[model samples]
Target: MDSPHGAAVKAEDFGLKGPRGWAFRGIGLDAAPGSLIAVEGPSGSGRTCLLLALTGRMKPTEGHAEIGRHRLPKKMAAVRRIAALGPVPGVNDLDQSLTVAEQLREGALLQRHYGAPIRSLFRSRAERRATAAARIDAALDAAGLDLATLPKGERTTVRDLERLEAVRLSVAIALLGSPQLLALDDLDIKLSDTERTEVWALLRSIAARGITVLAVCSEAPADAVVLRTGPKEDGAGAGRDADAKAEAEPAAKAEAEPAVEKDSGAKKDAETGPATATATENDADDTGNDGNDDNDDDDTKGADDALAEAGRA
Candidate 1:
């Protein structure tokens, strides 16, 4: 398969907010097509969210980003069609029970079913199978994965493969769709120094093929474009604090409301002591207040006015 030109990625003040707080914010980035963009940050620094947002899998709360001619999040579906995710935990993790061949076939089938043009679905089963097989082979070659080297060759389950091999398989699966932009998370997890170098080299080679590669890692390769998503201390913390304060204000008002009402009611009751007593006595003496109807009405009206004012407070 020939290389496809990748999308140019650009962002300004990009941000994503979650229920707890802003996952990431104040991000600025610019990278040309086919650039190997490294998202360098610690574990909880919102690197994953940034990756998903860039690929249009997750929407941003503020600012904007452009993937090729498609703008996020308005063109999220468009961006999603051109971009693919590789080995993202909780998003596209490889199934441990599936064999290498099974996983590759699954990817090809899913791509055909969802990503392919409507006319492609009309192709004969044999033609479709051949096409899938060819794409799988091309993907395996691009990913530098050799089935012969594995302990069980094509039958090797994901859990049985070594870390690097699993990574390669995941990349190959992602490549089956011929995505112009590929995003990978945790590139250096549980790998030795030599393995990390190999992973970076693999990504660089993919980028060299005119495919944009977005990789998340603790450190970035010197030659690649780097976008660092720092911890919450870098502006996002203030947003979280503001959110907390906003929530707290309503609860504080609710608590203070009852106290104010009680205090006002007590103050009004004390000031209208005689009126309050007379009103209570009139309530107990149901039919006897007709004798001095004018005075009784005056006391009752005064007490009612005082109660209404207290309730308003």
Candidate 2:
């Protein structure tokens, strides 16, 4: 689990404050090297902030943390040097305008400039390019990003990628630095159930290869150390907590209902619906139109029109 820049990251009662309020407070972690840590919480609950704080990209106003040999706040720069970030919004992010290969090359250049010895600058351009290529290949392999599988291979722009594919590319770019710890924010965001499972498995595989991983998710793997953040964690009365939970349940259901209802309604309409402008039209069709006559043509026409409108939308 020992790495040049990798070490067990530990935090003791660490916390940070933002303009809105406390991002997180009284949080703790004791992740071993190469272990997977999941910071689980809802939206705007400081999961992303906690990941940055632990990685030394963000300062913790209270308590302390250790990343590699560096301590937070005091040695923020040193900590950032060893930790690699993925999709953290303002910190480190994949460039949407660049093709996959271009991004990889950029990462390799940055790594060499910062990580290599000063004497390496004297190396021939060809040699440096070769070194960069090797590092990119290794990093991509570690990240499980198969460029060949992409629609345009390495030439594909980042904006065109699937959520999971983009995540992989970001992770691969981070790995180019050979970071001791790989930390990603919002690992499960906008991903399907199967994709989430695959991402967790990928993180686990990265950890198995001796790189530490910190991921943010709404739900953590069973074996992961879960750090939760939210509005309800502070002191609160049992009555108030109950009230909050009672209130929150309906809100959550309300947020989820539209999608479920839309899907179910569409399916029902597809199965049994016959479009008529008025109730009388249905009655007229039922009585005057031959019941024995297959109205399949009319049904098919309505369905086709509906499908066309949906397509245009």
Candidate 3:
């Protein structure tokens, strides 16, 4: 099987607002076909949402994008047909109980049944089986997975495989479709530095074959096109700092006011004491109200969870 020509990706102010809030906003990207594109960001920073949006698994609310010739939010179905997801949690996950060979066979069967042309199904059963085998072999080679090196070879279950090996298996399954665009989430999670480097090498090799690779990671490889996601220029940190200051201002004023009245008589104490104390209590209540502002960023996580659940459904 020959390698497919990769898909070109372009986006401008691409954003997705979910049930909670904006998952990602103001994203911009333009990459050529066969490019190794890495989506780098902190956890809960909408990295996964951006990956899904680019792959057509999630729709963008604010901006527009193009995957190959397919336009986003409108041509999502077409984009999905050309893009394959690799190891995205809660979406297209591998079964832990399945053996290595079983996983590969299942991927191959799914691709053959839905991805392949209807005319191809007219072939004899033996021929179809042979073709599926060839596809599996090609995908394994492209993904740099050698099953013979595993502890139990083809019989090895997913839970028993090492981290790098599991990643390789997922990539191989994605390759079974010969997708023009491959999107992988959490590419560097739970792996050593050496393994991260190796996995980047593997993705680069796949790109060398003219397949566009979109990967999500905490940090990106030097050679890949990097896109970072997070809060806007008017960031969340500044807002939190401002909120903290607002909460402290009344308390500071309340403390200073009582000091000036210390030299007053008992009558002054009776008159001003309750008022000062009441003001201080009100300030404390206000501070507690301000604390709720701290939870604004948590909405991003909620949005992500909602999207993940929608994907699974």
Candidate 4:
């Protein structure tokens, strides 16, 4: 279960920009604590950037937000502790070489060292180890992942795990500390309709139990608090101005975009952790537990919230 302190999220006049233009900028919304918020938009529409800002990984250039009791760009450190990411390409990808158990353990260690109460650092090794084990178990259960059911049990390498299993494991790791808010990107990117339904069910259950969830989808379901986003021009409508602009600067626009590769091809990005899929244009996230600095790339700080990783696994 999430901590009893699950937070409500609110934003006003929030925005972030890049050299190409605004990634996303607008007046934000107010959501009741533990509400399910879906950010829906097409690729390059700034869904990923929006997720980063809401979670406090990226500071907004224009407005502000209240995540729980903390404020953005001010108390973002607190926001970082309460919110975590799941399967955000470039931020939370699985380490394909490691077994499921190993990933869980590593994630637990990372969360404990960076996310838990500072007093935990003073605990005895044995006590910490026991706590970590229990943490993993609870998170796996909460995420609906039963290690024993896997083909090789917990010993299965991420390389061998099925797509759904990979998704579950990614979620399970993010829940290790039972963060009050969970942010999952690319919610409908890879899964089939049935798989997407199952994932939504899982997210709903997580939210119902008091952990707020922010999901990215091509479109929001009727039941969610939807935050629709896309490229800057989307807000302006598909009029002649938008068409003319794109037609006039296709090459420049394409060069400036940080591509999200959905195909099987893989290439490494700069500055973030290993395993990040190369962007045809630029980079923003890395898949794994480590994030990057804002200055490192035009992409938002990848590791600023929940050692995010990106990977098919």
Candidate 5:
């Protein structure tokens, strides 16, 4: 389906090459309204890079990418308005000093402060506070975060919460703007399997509500349309062929041995018995050809007599 913003995202021949000569290339993708796409690859394989490009946070060196109706600009203000990016774990940028409730309230206020006209800024204080509070509460509820359950019930700082709770708070802050597109980076990083499952379920539920969801993960979820990046196609094929060759070598060697042994055994039997019989016949002929049989006997008898005399002496 076409997005209300015209096109949700479009990238053509997008690529990024680092100073170290490592590169990720050959990417072409489109994400539309009500669509959920996932970028999956091993560490350093450019999944995060691609996600950033699609969200207009980073520009591609070679190709063009668009989010909503705007091409990536030197400044991403327009794209940032229509899209919300979730926080990266371990990054100290999610307002760690503020309480969960305060963070959500601040997020909504900031979006309004930046986007609203200056004429509206001078509105009555009571009306503005009521609007901001309602928006913050709605965002927190949608994220399944209840600040009332915290130690000080809306006054608890982020530093006091567990890692999972912090992540949920970050999600709530992102959702406060009610963006048309949600870009989540490393959604499953460091999460337990069950926690990952829960997060995926939440994302799916969000997508079901009609927001386009794009996430970068080490592996793709079952319901996500995965865009994978890694080695070149030829390199992958060569590796598979090499593995197949290695597996076949042992079986080929095993089949060859029996034929060699049979040939050697036949040769040995053919030579041994005949050669021994011929040697015996030659010995008999040599004895028969000693025509001076009596002389031979006399010489043998003399040798025996000499040995007997030596023993007696």
Candidate 6:
């Protein structure tokens, strides 16, 4: 498909195999600019690996991909420039100790040091600084991260911030360059439900601005194109089904036992009614447990809040 922003991302027959075994295979995707594509799978399903290949961070064993006008190369510097990654933020390999503003400044400086003209670097320091400030402001604004809210604001160190904040900071740094394609890994790792919704909204907004976003998530969002990665083992699906059954059995028993106890209680008012009451209590307890189990399952099946937030941002 053609991209809205004039940059298309395609991965054809992409497969990645390692010393252990095949991480992923038969992966093919095409994302238009302004679209959000989600790679959905369990942990260790090669989502991150696939992301690397598509973004030119790692080479696929059997196929290739294209970002914008540049094809994947043995060296991916060109593609990396146009595709900013949200994972690990700041730099591609981040320095964990740096403050938020320092990381942003360093990122802009590095981009200039590598990509800007030498004369421009020397002759227009003020202009360069202004450009960096504008880009940073735009990125932060887009991310819904107000530096002023932090105790140290821009001066707050990455290590000092919470995980969600760090994720946002990383996204802001990635946006500093105004990349054509944004690739994020595990956009929602750990966040509250409200936070997750906000994050997803932010990602959609970013896509609306004409950047293609490819994100790795455990569950697919409504607006994204979902890619499924199956379970790790052959009978994993069966095992999961069995586990669900095991969880439901106790609740079923509790409900059924209560009815039996009620039937038996019809003969006596106090003594038999005690048995019925005990059964009712057990049913309540089991129902509560079942409810908790269902909640746990939902959490597992849902997207990671931190990653989701980053995607939305």
Pick by TM-score: which candidate is best? 3
lDDT of 3: 0.67
The whole-model lDDT of each prediction reads: 0.66, 0.60, 0.67, 0.63, 0.52, 0.55
lDDT of 4 by residue, 92-204 (tens): 46679978876665565455434555566687867766666666677788789999999899889999988878888888877775777888888887789899888999999
Global local distance difference test of model 5: 0.52
Clashes of each: 0, 0, 0, 17, 0, 14
lDDT of 2 by residue, 1-313 (tens): 1233346888888876533345577888887888888888776666665776676444566778887666664554455556777655433446688788766655554444344546667878677666666666777787788999999998999989999998988887777666778888778879999999999998988888888888888899998877777763543212321222232234323322332223423322221101000111112232323232232112222211321211111
Between which residue pairs do clashes occur in model 2? none
What is the TM-score (0 to 1) of candidate 5? 0.66
RMSD of each: 25.7, 23.7, 23.0, 10.4, 39.2, 23.9
lDDT of 2 at 61: 69
Worst ten in a row by lDDT for model 5: 271-280
Sort by TM-score, best first.
3, 1, 4, 2, 6, 5
Stretches of candidate 2 off by over 4 Å are: 1-5, 232-313
Better by lDDT, candidate 3 or 2: 3
| Candidate 1 residue lDDT tens string, 1-313 | 4477998999999977766566688999999999999999877777877787787555567788988877765555556657877776544556698787666655554554345556666878677666666776788898999999999999889999999999988888777667779988888999999999999999999999999999999999899899987768544443432332233234323322332223323322211000000011122122332222222212212211321211111
Model 1 regions more than 4 Å off: 234-313
Where does model 3 exceed 4 Å of error? 232-313
lDDT of 6 by residue, 139-160 (tens): 7887678999998988888788
Tell me how far the alpha carbon of residue 132 in candidate 2 is from the true structure, in angstroms, after superposition: 0.9
* Each prediction's TM-score versus the true structure: 0.74, 0.71, 0.75, 0.73, 0.66, 0.68
Tens digits of per-residue lDDT for model 3, 191-285? 99999989999999999999999999989988889999876443432232122223333432343344333342421222100101112221122
Assess candidate 2 and give its lDDT.
0.60
